[model samples]
Target: MRKRIALLAACGLLAIGTAAVPANAAEPVFPLVGPSALELPLPVDGSGAREQRLSITLDHPATGAPFAGLFTVDLRKVAGVATVRDHASDSSHQCTEKDGELLCAYKGLPVSLELDVAAAKGAAKGATGEITVTGKVPGATVTPLTTKVSVGGPDLVMREMKLKKDLRPGESQPMPLVFANEGTQAAKGVVLELGTTRGMELVETYDNCRTRTAGDLTTVLCSVEGDFVPGAAYELAGDSPLHIKATAHAYDDVLRYGIYPAGDEPKAAASSGKARAGRKLGVSPAKSAPAAPGLRASDLNPGDNRREFAFHTENTADFTTSPVSLKGKAGDTLSTAFVFENKGPAWIHAANPADSLARTVVVVPEGAKVTGKPQECLAVDADGTKRAEQLGAPRYECALGNRVSENEKVVYPFDLLIEKVVEDAKGSVTVGDWGTSAPRPHAFDPNAGDNTAAVVINAKGGTGTGPSPSPSTSGSPSPTPSASVSASASASPTAKASTAGTGTTAQGGNLASTGSTVGPIAVGAAALVAAGGALYVAVRRRGVRG
Candidate 1:
């Protein structure tokens, strides 16, 4: 019976001992997970210094054991001076075990440590400090991780610009620049300045730009429109290439909040706006085209309201060469051909007198002397009324055939006959004016009267036996021909054949009398008429529109 009783007691004692093992262990236990250590980073002497405080508390430091005594705290500086009071301290507290956990009987507030660093008035270099805690709970181990306090001033480093070269005139190109805060200090009041070249114009915000001129450099104030965080790069784009420089600044307190920490790498220069100056602006060049030629009419018949004789001009060395010359004994026939081109966007109608575009250039050929009444065509007034008349029986009436488009050419033939001339001691044949006469009614149209040529030949004659000059009026008998003339005394002119427009021939080829209006109805009617005419021609030719 005694032996069994002893065995039961031993079993009970073993269980109780196992339970109390952790409660009675001697170990220093922190009331919080982190220590109450104070750390002061490098301090300046005069100016205000930034302050940072870290509060660490552990809810349950004595998990299962009593906190004994002898806890140690350590302060260290990674780059700057780290000062502290009572970095290592210890306190003894009587603890008790309840349930399975060891609890402190008296829990006093943590020991207080005051820390202050000196600050200087002027700029100072950067630095950092660290604080760590090493302590123990009864029968257990505890080591708190280190906390850091960084210190420094504003760090200025330029970054890339987002502008490209080849900017065109009157066009705005966006420019972007990035900057970084690499120091322990947080940058504020950063200013970026841009300078203008000769042709550059700044975009105004309020009708004008706020500018400050500093000797050779002009600084324009531009706002930093966006925010940038510490250790983070900020980018901004502006109007275009006008040289710019960027710097960083801030209000006093920075390091305490751990801004732009040390060990931050400097951004590469390639990321800076300074590199963009090497890029150039771009533009496209201009090109030119060739020139056109010059030409004019050689001669025209005013009487028949006919087409003028045109002559293409060649390169002239001098202005003296005679374009036309005429010499005729009392009676003779003069024939000449006028070469012409259509030079037109619209087709010419030879049959339509109202549509005819003819100007007369009468030429008296060189060496040809003419004698007798020279005929003339009376020009109608602006009212389309005539005022003068022609002499004895009209001789030649002519109008050139229809002209083609500018791509085509046409030619007209002319003939004139000489009627009479009075013999003079000088042997000169005088061409008399036979068309213009007072007290006589004028002809209504250009073809009604004789239209004389502009040039008249009066000198003796040329060596070769060429065609003789024609008389202006060929109705009467001509003078007797002398041996010197060697040509017939009577003259005759014939007209040439032509093919142009054969429409309802309503007095055509007359610009002044056309009297046409450009009204919508007229245009529509003309279009319909043209369409019908085209359809009729197509049908007559047995052709289809497609």
Candidate 2:
């Protein structure tokens, strides 16, 4: 029988997001998705087999709407040399295995249903098997998804490094990208990718690598294809050691890198900026006993293939905004924008591209109905809940992207129809944290008093606020009960900024990286944030925190 399930494209293997399918609003199709394959580690010294997982998750269609309700997943198997086990002890899971078939009756969507996989005793290296999973949802079509398993394969692990210590503005530091093939077979080639956070840039321009802009980030992708022998380690020998420079605007940031078998890089639009400097990044066996070897040929264990090192340059940024006071009478339509500027010894940014940047909130004075606003701004009620009607809301919030360069000014324009201008009608403009009513202390901001600005109309007895081109030191003019904000550049109807950054790895610090312990960046208390695999938070001395 033909398997009627949808298999995620064999590349990248999720290794993860809800892949969005394009479908009609009335007839959305759900695509079943999971890793393309699994690798079980059969330790060479007879340490028994290392376990991997047969995890399955779902991807929605274009609308971003997720399906709800119960769905049944049946794992009809094709026997092989690998063993599959269920986690009965996990209180929330409702799955059972019988007659060599696994069935899970899951509620809503299968966020992730994982089954343990390992090489069976006496299984030879390279032994393989398959599992076909089909979903049953009434009136819904989910093409079946299948994942293969091998007893052993190439395992690529990255090595962490100590970045240059006491990094200062405009100073550069060398980061050696190192990894090893720790599997039974050779890896044919590997793809190395680097993402240096905001305020930093990759210094080398090589023919084998291309640089692409991601919002405020610079990502470099290098292809170094060659035979990697098992048990041998390898490092990319660029024309020079790879170095990342902290620019004059740098403060806290991270260097994110990953190693993937050459063929497995996720498909992206052929982005330009593939600068060729006539240099090929060559690979060589590590001078250590290990030789540089081989990728997914499927990594028996794909979890240890990426690393992120967070560092801070001694710097601070002062972001200030001011109240704009206006004198308008009844029925007079007024035009204005709430704005702020970065006065910097440093620039401010989210750690990664997909992370949220600072925001700007604008509330109109009493008796004024908002008639014109930015498309990026969201209309919300007093409590910050999104309003069904976008215009004429009491408050509006906008996204500022993940980065704000030095001296950059972000403004959000608004046109207010004064219904009946009242004396000293006051509004508010506050900037901080991704669109929130309350913000966590910006540990790097030195001037707290200028964070909030005021907007007022029809002055009387010194009441109309937010006017004046100067930063307010008269304390907070919390005119609006609902707090939400963000901004970018001056544009029609509103302001615009860079697109928000992207994310990698949905969960866990264990996914895909070479096993390199981090250097000076790890000296502080480490906080693991799994929204993006292995994205970590660390607080440092000298008051800089990441």
The C-alpha RMSD in Å for every predicted model, in order, reads 39.9, 15.7
> Which ten residues in a row are the worst by lDDT in model 1?
532-541
For model 2 the local lDDT of residue 301 reads 63
Q: Could you tell me the C-alpha RMSD of candidate 2 in Å? A: 15.7
Q: Model 2 residue 429 lDDT?
A: 78
User: Counting only residues 3 or more apart in sequence or on different chains, how many pairs clash (N, Cα, C under 3 Å) in candidate 2?
Assistant: 45
- Tens-place lDDT digits, model 2, residues 1-546: 012113234344542323335353455556666776777778557787777756666555444443443434433343657777765454335666777777676654334456777777888876777766666554455656667777777778888877774678889967777888777877787778788767788876778887777555577778876787788888766455677899888898778887777665433512456755866778777765444434447666667887888878888887666576655455554445555456676877776767756666777778888776556567888788889887789987766666666755444445566788588788887777663574433678888787787677766765332222221122112121112222111212211121111211111111122111110111101111122111111111121110
Q: Where does candidate 1 stray beyond 4 Å?
A: 1-45, 59-70, 76-80, 85-129, 148-150, 153-235, 239-546
lDDT of 1: 0.27
